[model samples]
Target: MATETLTYGNGTSLQASNLPLNGSSAGKPVDIAMDARRVFEVLKNGGLAIVPADIGYGLVAIDPKALERAFVTKQRQPHKRHAMIGSYALHKELHVLPEREANMVELLTRDIDLPLGVIAPLKMNHPIVQKLGSETLARSSVDGTLAMLVNGGKFQDELVRLTSEAGLPLMGSSANLTGKGTKSLVEDIEPEILAVADIVLDYGKRKFSEPRPSSTMIDFRNVEVLRFGACYDVIQDVLVRFYGITLPEDPGRGANFSGHLREAAKR
Candidate 1:
């Protein structure tokens, strides 16, 4: 497929917006066919797209080179790990859990409003992670843990399905540069990042505010709160309200995977 090449810096960005602002479909949004076609072309060709995410737009792609390009565009450090949004099917395949907790973990992370990330140990080799990013990939290989995001929404599910069809799990990171404030609005993206992306899917701004963060991340093995970014309060309530389970403030008490918890430069 010949991809429509878009470049930036002359004056304006070559946006893959819903519709050309002044054309025949000026006021009409880009139909699903055009949208999906662009998405397929970007991922298939190692191109990058800034697509809508649960919290904000995300730098999405299945190609390793595209992922690496995102790392550069975000100005993110090499030590940061990129989280992936994938189907329950892929989640079940990649994350190896004890029989007693597998189902429970799935219940906690999937089919929810707040995006949740599960850090599960790899049951088998996922060479695809190498393409996702190096900083986190190197760390995860040593730690033996991978963070997987499971989104149940139809839109996100479609992307996951597409990734599966392509034979790779979809991986992405919030489109924000490190240390800068997190941004959910399309207009908030830095020019440098926009310039590098092959396509920018700009529908509009997001609804959530500071209180709302990206997916709340937890370790899959023990259900420890890795970071209370998004839906931290609601998830905590959901655990106890429905399942009669309460997370330990210090889930590290057992510390089953100290190697994973500890920094590994010297390991």
Candidate 2:
């Protein structure tokens, strides 16, 4: 099928008509309509698109079937999970997490400059979340400017509407091969990934700093840090302040780390 294209503008008519939200398609090749709502729809329909972030642009696909194809194209392992991004509205549609976890989501949504990820449980069970483990879900949000690149202005609302309409949670992650540089445009993506993609949204070329490895993942299930990444220190501080729990000083095994945190708490 021919890819659909939509030019986002400042007009509210598009939002009222839900035109951008309706354009997203799954299982069929559809060019990104260029609106955040539309992109969300495309993702919900199992289509693939590219998103530009403060750090850089990455690939996004909401459909599990499409994601499987994306992983193969990027040579990404199935065990490694993807992240999610959208407006606050989109975040609310996700699983109803604990207040503390909800607070984290609010904090990230409030700060447009911080490029962080939220690990929570999916609102509902699905093969994707099941594969990642039931204890957590991934959530993220790009700055408004980045949202505008895809959808003119109502980026957040559009995202919420599309996801709600499709009843699918999106998998957000950087668009690059594992341990390789992230591609900025649809054309730059490795051909392997492109071949399996149902839709390829091109936002043109962009310069990016050395890709920051994936965000550190924390399993709120036990309120423990799982993998340490760029946001480790920040997450540590948050957990400590909010839950009165301290993390380990040493950056080693769980036994050692937990022991360290316990020792510090005692003091």
Highest TM-score model number: 1
Which parts of model 1 are misplaced by more than 4 Å? 1-34, 109-113, 126-136, 139-142, 207-210, 243-267
What lDDT tens digits, residue by residue, belong to model 2 across residues 1-267?
Answer: 334433222222211232342234442222333456556656766687655443445566766666666666677655555555554555454445688766665664454223344445544444433433323232122111011111112333355456645555555566777655555444555655544444444434443232233344444444555444334566567657766778644354333332223333555
Q: Give the deviation of candidate 2 from the true structure as CA RMSD.
A: 11.1
TM-score of each: 0.74, 0.54
Which stretches of candidate 2 lie above 4 Å from their native place? Answer: 1-34, 37-46, 82-87, 111-113, 125-160, 181-188, 198-213, 228-267
Q: Which window of 10 residues has the lowest lDDT sum in candidate 2?
A: 143-152
Q: Could you tell me which 10 consecutive residues in candidate 1 have the lowest summed lDDT?
A: 256-265
Model 1, span 76-175: residue lDDT tens: 7667776677657777877788874676665665545456677788754655554445654663443778887765344466767777766665777776
What TM-score does candidate 2 get on C-alpha atoms?
0.54
